[model samples]
Target: MDWMPAEKAIEDVRVIAAPEPRASADLEAQLARALSLRWEEVVLSIGRTQMLSTSRTGLSLAQRDRLVRDVSVAILTQIDIFLERKSDRFTFQTLLEELADEERTSVASKVGAAIADVEMEKSGFRFRANARELTFEQFEATQSKNIPDFVYDSGRGDETTPSDVVAVEAKGSLSRLRATKSRLKNLAKKAYEAQVQAFVGSTANDSIAVTGGCAIAFGATPGNGDCTLRLYVSAPAGGTDSGGAGAAVRGPGLGGARIPRSLSSAANAMQQLDKKHEIERESATLDPQANGNGPGHHRPGRKRRRGPNAHGRIAFANYETVFRLCGAANAALMLRQCLDGAVEREDNPVMQAFYQSSSDDRFLFGGTPFAKCWSPSGYFAIYKPAAEAILEALAANRSTPPDSVTLPELPKDLSWEHGAFAAQADGLTWMSMVRGDFTTKIWNLSSGKW
Candidate 1:
């Protein structure tokens, strides 16, 4: 599989701004199709790699296949279900609230259980496959504990001992909302603090040890109606500052992105409309025609048609732009985390060797892997490099290059298998391949291994 370039990906996103009924319908179909294709591309690509193929992990080929199918179906089903009942005006929070508890559980469990084999209990805390084992939750004998939405306990295989755990807090929000960066940071901090508290409080039980935490924000972008999954890893708490860890791991926000322009323009346009309405009201009140039978009075010239739904159109465009920007930023952050995690873990000797020889440290963002290979970000990150590569190719092909390009940052920390990387990249590439401007060199690694 080859990767789509960034330019083409942006163009695909632009389709969300297309007019009316066709835009909404096309967006939904594209999302489902893209997600399904990406899922298959990931499975097949990883299946051929020696790293995953020969792993001692209990996941067999059949299990992997089933896992992919079940999880993808669950995700698509939930999305479709949400869209079916969505109102003209709804927020990401609204969608989240509307989803039944069972539906939410299905989404969380399918992803958690398949990737790490974690099981959710009726109590809302997740555990490993073993019955006696319980993933660490903030256990309070008197009151409800502030536990994460999902916890994956990598148990030590000894029932008496505590296992390292990964805690995930799931959140949903509108991509166009204000202060998203702060909101996400706060959410991640809260989840991380709860995990630390649970780890400390559960010392008496000796059941689970908190290793890391993740915050997964599922944002619903309005225009194209696509969902953006942003994953943030919580850094370990340092000193007395509870937020230090979160601050360290905070993902990039939509700074100076085109989203702000869209929002500003929309606001300005709305203000102009409001002023026009106010002027009309005043004019009508002062008009001689209102007094009846003024010979010199003539009907006011018809106001230039602004169309029936001009405001609605502008608002939707703004929402779509914000969603697209946030989604891309989220994807970039996830990819950076994956590359950094793979490099830092030193799981692959080849990757480790490359890191040792590399002079640049910017490639590896400092953080511990929350769930290693099973982390959702790792899978998502696989698509980043390829996407960027394709975008680069497209930019180069243009008669006049773009003033700026927004693409995921390439991972510098690890040596990649050409086929594996290409396959992963293809997951995103397929989306933009229709541009007909890309080249095979987009997948080739020149200069260094990574």
Candidate 2:
């Protein structure tokens, strides 16, 4: 494993500053479109319940059903399709005990990842794309190198000017044995190095912007104690590399910002995650083709352009690292309709507009870091697939949805009622659910916060 002394960890890993107003507004608009697209897709899900989604799934519904059927017959067990839906929601003994050890382990992993995602959003980073969705070939081409979990929108470029993005790698660990802050420090530093190697692609940005990755880990379901978090901002690929790990340390409020002994809860998370851009050297070097089409090619960053000391080259480093800890997408998902009929479930028109506006079509959905329902105030998809188009529709078009981008019926009852799930950077903080019914049926994912 990579090695970084305790003193260096304190000096190097740090939080980023908040995004500029323009970038924030840009992301907000993109987020609105993304959430709007989800509304449309969910409506379609209602329509195609019988159909099997053959797209991005671990198992087809039919396959799963067949597997269940085989297993049930072999064991003389009845397959109750509605067992989950019909089961007692108020079953006190089965709050989470129903899961097997392995299942719990898997869930614990996701929960840790989800909490990390929540922390990043709470800190102000925007998810752009998920690397896992892409194929190996596609991965190397469209996504950033080193395969950081998700790329942030970068909020820097436009149709004319290609912008850069910050590629982040998520670090999630189940603290099985007695782990210490010293150990996690090296992991964070290692993540920083991964971020350094990442080259932003997708024809959006030429060079990367800001440090990625934040160093934070979560306790496993059976683990003990709070985890440490060092939100490090590393020297980006295009940015100037700090001479070494011993460079000067800086952050949004470096002198004032107190490094947390551990990110024990949401209360400790920074209000607005903003960071200064100290990378040196300017200009996005274009590829030989220079057509601005396809995954445009470009060379790696040149020699270290004297940037700030903190944003320098170090042994272990980069993120959408505790940026921490964690984070994480798709399309007309095709479907096999009933009655042996092949239905072309038309893709969302609103999404079509958004996709049409996008230069890269690899992304199917917006990057949402947290689980189904973990955002403190709740979270929404924020990647801007159709940013410019949506802006135009809202501004000039006379129609309610601008003719091309009609929105779905607003969502309802998506939030938890008292005992859903509350999380922090460390892990799933708590779970509660007195009743399963949602009486309010309110649509919380509106325009602004989304």
Candidate 3:
């Protein structure tokens, strides 16, 4: 595909920061339009050339899916960059400053840094601050107590009691800007609860006081896209269990309360294109001629028996398809490890028996390192040995040998390039052993059994 054109389109779309007294509505509009147009072009190209038509580029179905995923990631990365611009009020730093200014509190400056420290430590579940870890018990105790917007030690050796603790609550949205208000409310409740717990654990003096507030950053705008910073002096009394009963505090300046029309429109347009592509794929799958299914001519009662050869072909085809998509180096390494683990494990009687009986080192690998056996042709060679091992084990103890092991049915149109059999990848490592819902035949030897 002509990827350079699309890349250029994305590069050309620039969002200039809005000056004071102006909103970013125009910039958002331009970005939304440019991105949406490029997205439509790319999606339409994939749908028409790859999904709807037969593959002429020699790329497998799995490779096509990976390509689509890569394109989607690129689009999302651009959106992330746009939202992360320094001048945007939706940026994390901007929101913190707005919250501090609204509360007219000196402690707000430290709230952002404290939150950063807690996050970096991965202690959100049990936050560590002030050189100590606060448990859920402490958090619950101060649920009803008033907390400050920012709190810290005075560093004066004379006074040791914890006083005027600041609690900060902040939330931001990139995709779900519309949910900013509700998310902020939820964060506010959580912040209050945490602050209250800290205060209760720190001092017996209830008069020491706690102050705090909530800041919501959202949308592609200067003043955080309709979201405002709010501050609270004390925890609300007898509130709706959420500690939100305090008087509503509003910050200075107008906040963007709604997502810009252009942005939402662009998002909706891309979604529609994706939905359209899905419908087309479904339609193609259902068409018998397109999927390689011949006219029905089978006797109704006759049971079709699939032998080890069929099973092997299906496994080989599915694995090879995925291996090509994931790249030869990574796929070869992972597949070998999966097969090796299955063979070594004592829990899986089928794999254990197969490995013991089979002398073919080409497919079974035996004790040989995968790096030595790695080849484009070697990938195709391993399927039969893997399939035979499982089939042989299934037939060993059963009175009536499983006449045919069911495997995952591939799409009707998919050609095997060899003997006919259907299969799907069960994981990155193994393919389905049989078609149909019979759980016993499925081989996940890497995990020991089906």
Candidate 4:
């Protein structure tokens, strides 16, 4: 059995920085510095008492800088403790649990404030009241806490001034485990209500005032936490800001925001989500030939499966490695779905060939790796039929296939070539392409076979 090193456990983490105001440029900088604590010595605090303790070690200078940057006291301490305990070598799943623990408090606030500020600056808007003391009663009675995250209006009194306005509450953390659904639900509700309050207060008398939208993010999940960061967003609601709580914004609930931790590490996961939703929604309105089309490509319909044996098992590594090499549609995905359907349905040639061909290095290793199958030519034969079918469908320029033809089934291997198209300089095994059909172009990373 292969052993994974502790450092490789997390691989990397992608955190969305809460947006902060351009005006708070000074405050943000200070806050970032203060939290990063690069300048300050690590001090242990217990309630009102502060003590300098050197016992808590294992923090590298870079690690300390990151702690300062994340502005998370709890996470830093936890990480230090992790190193001290050597818990970093725990299973990947366990590491996520640890991360969740680290992000419960200060990290949340820091992330929230930063996000709020960036959004404000981006839209040339300002928080009506930031961290402004609002007594529970004052917040409720003044109804000032119900504002939407953002607001846009035609004009208040001055016609020359831009009416566009925005408000966003940024939240972040390093916690791996997530708050309970009930708790998160309640938080979302309160936050939404607060957003509405902000919305009304800002729009006040303006008839054209509009609440842009809202967002949320944390290290926790609606999805399995494999250190996969996800985001969710909603379109700005236009029209007059109706008095009372504006319609509550909805989120993906549990499964959404699959952002990897590479680019935009500091961007609020929510912002990434909002941007994605925006793209999807906009694409829905466009014609296939429009300049801005959704992931416009055709594929054969999803194939039905009978059982696991009916479809052959696939090594996850091989799937991923091949996809990287193919540089087209998801190589791994195509393999799994096709194999699953073949096995389940007990298709004679496909299933037999799949099982036979999948032996050797492919089965021994996980996912799609660089290893070749027992029979490359035979494997190609089974794969080619599907590939040709897919090409034919794409060439036909169809979005959804007709009921007559079966859809492409999920690949037997769960691996994907998604990150495989990245620049060679990126130095990662996975390649990533920003725009293109990642599944179709099967460029082999090893032999540079296209």
* TM-score of model 2 (CA atoms): 0.37
Q: Per-residue alpha-carbon lDDT of model 2 for 1-450, expressed as tens digits?
A: 011110111122234322221121221111110001121121111111111111123565445334422332221111111112222210011233354656544433343344344444344343233433323442355434465554443233333433333444555443444124455555555765564233323322222233333333333212222333433343323232234433223332322232332334312332222122212113323222212221211113312122111110100011111111112101111101211123334343322111111322211122232233322212212122122212222222211111112111111223233433333211112222222321211111111111
Order of candidates by lDDT, top first?
1, 2, 3, 4
Q: What is the number of backbone collisions in each predicted candidate, taken in the order shown?
A: 7, 31, 27, 104
Error of 3 at 274 (Å): 57
lDDT of 2 at 103: 51
Runs in model 4 lying further than 4 Å from the true structure: 1-103, 112-159, 172-186, 195-198, 201-215, 221-450
lDDT of 1 by residue, 1-450 (tens): 222221111011110111121111111111111112233232322222212212223565345434543444445345434442332221123455455656654544333222221111111121211111122333544232454544433211121233334444545443445214455345434544554234332321232344444444433443443443334443332311223222222112211112324556645654775587456334432222211111211124412211111111111111111112212322222222221222123232211110110332211211222123332322222233333332232223222111111122223234333223212111211111111121221121111122
Name the runs in model 2 displaced over 4 angstroms. 1-105, 132-146, 154-164, 176-179, 194-196, 200-216, 219-225, 236-450
* Ranked candidates (TM-score, high to low): 2, 1, 4, 3
Clashes of 3: 27
Which ten contiguous residues of candidate 3 have the minimum total lDDT? 288-297
lDDT of 3 by residue, 45-89 (tens): 222122211222345555654553353333333333332233222
> Per-residue error at 144 for model 3, in Å?
18
Question: Using TM-score as the measure, which candidate wins?
Answer: 2
Q: Residue 17 deviation, candidate 1, in Å?
A: 36
